[model samples]
Target: MKNYILITLTNALGLYIASLLFPAITLSSIAAVLWAGLLLATISLFLKPLLLLISLPINFITFGLFTLLINAWLIQLSAYLAKGVSIPNFKYALIPAIIIFALNRARLSLIHDKS
Candidate 1:
């Protein structure tokens, strides 16, 4: 339960920051959208990366960038699953997915640096 909340908060923070950077994505309100996005993105956090890995051959076949399209799709799916939240556009969804992915990778490196 605690881990779930933590992941949600992290995702919410990422989405909030992402909205600031991209104009197309708009949250109905910060708190509401944050929590909604957090919940939805938490599910994606667990599922999307594994799916992407499973499709790695095709992703590479399309040139590595196709993974970006997959990430964008997952983000849109999350928004679709979460009520009262809107991605506004695919370009908007792409922004947060990329930001979160890069941030997560950087965070993993930071954690390992301490160990």
Candidate 2:
């Protein structure tokens, strides 16, 4: 769908920007960035919600900071799933995860769904 394509593109842009800003996150090629973006989008769309649902109690207890940890985990998982994208450690992943999350949030806020 159009929305999915748009989201994937937005995610790709986010990854590109994050790589630029963070030396800790590297994209070996454009292809890798695109793959990382696609994997990230898929994981965010499917797995994140399920994990959030299962972690709701802990999320509530942590006053939502646990969601940031989840975001970092998702970023690391995307790195694992996509070749040539490497996040060396959780510390390396945290900032990029925050950046990507912010980028996606801003993109979603600015786009209105016609359907």
Candidate 3:
């Protein structure tokens, strides 16, 4: 539960940062940011693994680079599903995906180092 909440908060922060960095991505309000974060976390938790599995061949071929596309797709999906967050297209979502991925990686590394 604690980890889930932390993930949600990190995702929210990533989205907020992305919105600030990119004019193409927009979050209307704080509520929108939180909702988008929660939705993104949930979707990533449930859907990403399935996508990774399905895209294993391509992932292997690309040396795991295809995971970025999967992350972008997930971000696009989160934007579509969560109201008040707008990502114009898949291309626009890629950077946000990268930002979120970095944030999550850093978070995991910090947690591992502490343990």
Model 3 residue 98 lDDT score: 93
Clashing pairs in 2: none
List, residue by residue over 1-64, the lDDT tens digit for candidate 2: 8877776777778778878988878889998988888888899899999999999999999999
Cα displacement (Å) at residue 32, model 2? 0.7
**TM-score, per-candidate, Cα-based:** 0.74, 0.87, 0.96
What is the lDDT for 114 in model 2?
32
Best by TM-score: 3
For model 3, what is the error of residue 113's alpha carbon versus the real structure, in angstroms, after optimal superposition?
2.0
How many steric overlaps are in each model, in order?
0, 0, 0
The per-residue C-alpha lDDT of model 2 at residue 22 equals: 81
Candidate numbers sorted by TM-score from highest down: 3, 2, 1
* Model 1 weakest lDDT span, ten residues long: 2-11
What is the C-alpha lDDT profile of model 1 across 15-80, one tens digit per residue? 778878776666777776666657656767688778888989998898888877777777788777
